[model samples]
Target: MENRDTETYPLLTPLNHRQQNQTTTVVFNAESNDISPITGAGEFAREFLVESKKLWYLAGPAMFTSIAQYSLGAVTQVFAGHVGTLQLAAVTVENSVIAGFCLGITVGMGSALETLCGQAFGAGKLDMLGIYMQRSWLILNATALILSLLYIFADPLMKLIGQTKAISEAAGVFALWMIPQLFAYAMNYPIQKFLQSQSKIMAMAWIAGVALVGHTVFSWLLMLHLGWGLAGAAVVLNCSWWFIVVAQVVYVLSGSCGEAWTGFSFKAFQDLWGFVRLSLASAVMMCLEVWYFMALILFAGYLENAEVSVDALSICTNILGWTIMVSFGINAAVSVRVSNELGASHPRAAKFSLVVAVITSFAIGILLSLVLIIFRHQYPMLFSNDPEVRKVVIELTPMLALCIVINNIQPVLSGVAIGAGWQAAVAYVNVACYYLFGIPLGLFFGYALDFGVLGIWSGMLAGTVLQTLVLFIMVYRTDWNNEASLADERIKKWGGA
Candidate 1:
């Protein structure tokens, strides 16, 4: 049956043949066209090898960059944890809740560049990449200014959400110190996506590595040695992020990105409304996903032993976040592959890339799940010393493992949606699955039934499972040729091609 489908569709073809001008001409000249052909087990295996190499070529540096970048915060959290329980809760709350909110918005808005720049690059309209990035910077900076208000008023907001006075006050102070990091997010995400779209990720990885190392050194010196506590953690973290942003900007300006980094353009100022619309849709899609887990932190804060519950949940979420960086790397790679293929008018290649990415990410997810389960008892010691917090984390290990598995696949699918310019559609799915269905069910389980954190997580995991299934079906049934046409239309509409 698989062989029959392969022969009938003939989507998996040699990379060399697909790159030929003849194939490109045929694809764009025809209203409907089939991709290059492949036959036999040997040919199929060969194509698969070629596709995997291309996927990992991008994924490798992307993953390392993501992990190193994410570690900036994770390392800060570790430093905060050793300070004291109240300090741990405050840093976690500020990082996961306050900065997290801005991250979702800024990063999500920046993802609009992934779609635009990837397609534009594949379409060979490299000039548009820089323009699109500038547009994102403008939108995100404006967004950063507005979101700074959240930091300014974080204390009242946390209290309004039923947090204790102590945690609220500490977290609010931490939020103020983090205001610099928020603007850094605005600049960093767009630059990262811009570089990724052009496969210039190794530079990002190097920069992030440097930043992480510097962060660790400064955090140790200021937070621990000098005894500045949370203030020191905040200072180092903010500086580390800005270091990354500055390094990336310097690289782009150095002409290392070639055509993709054309000097600042007045053209970016044009078509402001259209860019904002797409950016808003992208923001909604990502914010829904990011803020979903964030809600767990919020809910955990309301439990009977609120500090312990919040501490354990934050630790669990932190661990989950580290694994998420791996998946997000795969996500970025697949998005680039799919969008590049579609923009190049190779629908079958786009579809084939999706198949390979899913298999690869799912396998990695399984491996990571096993590792987590094996180390479940020992890993919490890295984040907290409290006996109660460690005990609660052990109790939640099973659910955390399950979340790790599901999250691996979900982000890859969301990447597909972004690559195909389906942000609005996926945003609706997130709302239905995460908010309409998941949150309500979690409320019933956590509060009404008294299952506490475990019940709330289980309910939320159910929603994630449902969302993943829906996304899988969506991708499986996608008309790739139609999507390719849509990609062409998008590029033309944006004046890229």
Candidate 2:
């Protein structure tokens, strides 16, 4: 593991006057004699199996961590459901519409770390990870401040957006109480990517596990036993997330990542605008995808029997979110592997890794989809016992099952884009597919055709299908050689090696 690669550490360009004008780029061709490129069917199968192990090693824990963290919100929603139907609807709107917006922006913004830290770590420029992470922290904290303003005026904003007055007032209270969580997200996300890039991820999974357990107990005690209701749920969530942040900080400071973390540096404050540009690309890309579903919830708020409709849709979305964690986990793993391999200039390896990750995740998604289909009626009871909510959920279960399979494919391709540093391109595709076409079509179906909530969700699914197809084609046509070369150029330009 001691990478003594000259191309990865030393300034690879020649310093001699005679060769000063000539570049000294070292190409890590997969065809090099030292390592054979996977060619034959048997060899490719063996390579696929080997890479699957690596991919899953990263994905299994990553998925668990994602679920644990996301479950905090779901737990609060569940508790709210048990309390009363109104409380459940209130929490769903606030979480899906309000917090979901923040989630898209912050989580997406922090993903810039996946690109920077992943590539830097792959290049053996380990010292740069901390600086990249800190720079992300600064940019995202500023963004979070701007988003907090929305939370402050959430009620008016919702009413302006055409939500019911009663729903707006209740959701506003939940949103305001959830403000502290924004700052936690700002710090926690970059930390997650930074640790993940270096293959130091179990700490994240463990911390999340603890936080989820705490969220459940605290939500019950404070929200139910103490009868603090939504406020208690929000406060407990805030504390739980911060606990992960504090734990991760301690892990780094404890010298677990001797290669990556070196305390804090002023370098983090330098070249911020460069980081901002990439962060914004990721932010826009994520916001577009995440808000697509939240839009569904928003449109549902306008339907007849709005409360019942919103409640069912929210529960279904939670189910999707839970299972989607597996794909998200694969997304993270493939991002790291591709970025790392590309950074190391191994084109064939990176391509092979992507293939393995995609197939493996797709298989898992299919299995999960089957489970949802089989248990459609039984599963809704976990969130709410109301007969009407359950009935609406029954109607949507088929869509969720189908969407789960699509969800697995889309995120994996997005992961490939992230690893390849194509956030800006992906962002453009997202806007065109999800917004320019998807939303308008969804509106026509929902209102014009009077298909209601199911119509809106179906339209959103179409957008996802289009987005996934485009990304698949893009990935299929990618020249792995060019990607490796570009990764080298980007690392050098960033002064990594």
lDDT of each: 0.86, 0.84
Worst 10 residues of 2 by lDDT: 9-18
Per-residue lDDT of candidate 1, residues 1-497 (tens digit) = 12333332122221223345453322452223333556578766766776788788889899999999889999999988999999999999998899998899998999988888888777666778899899899999999999999999999999999999999999999999999999999999999999888888789999999999999999989998999999899889999999999999999999987777779888889888888988999999999999999998999898899999999999989889989999999999999988877777778778878888888888888899899889989999989999989999999998888898889999999999998889999999999999999989998899999999998998888999989999999998988878887775786565353
lDDT score of residue 18 within candidate 2: 21
For 428-482, candidate 2 gives per-residue lDDT tens digits of 9999899988888888889999999888888888999999999999999999888
lDDT of 2 at 87: 89
TM-score versus the correct structure, for each prediction = 0.94, 0.93
The parts of candidate 2 lying over 4 Å away from their true place are 1-28, 32-35, 492-497
The residue pairs found clashing in candidate 1 are none
Model 1 misplaced regions, further than 4 Å: 1-42, 494-497
Q: Compare the candidates by lDDT and give the number of the best one.
A: 1
lDDT of 1: 0.86
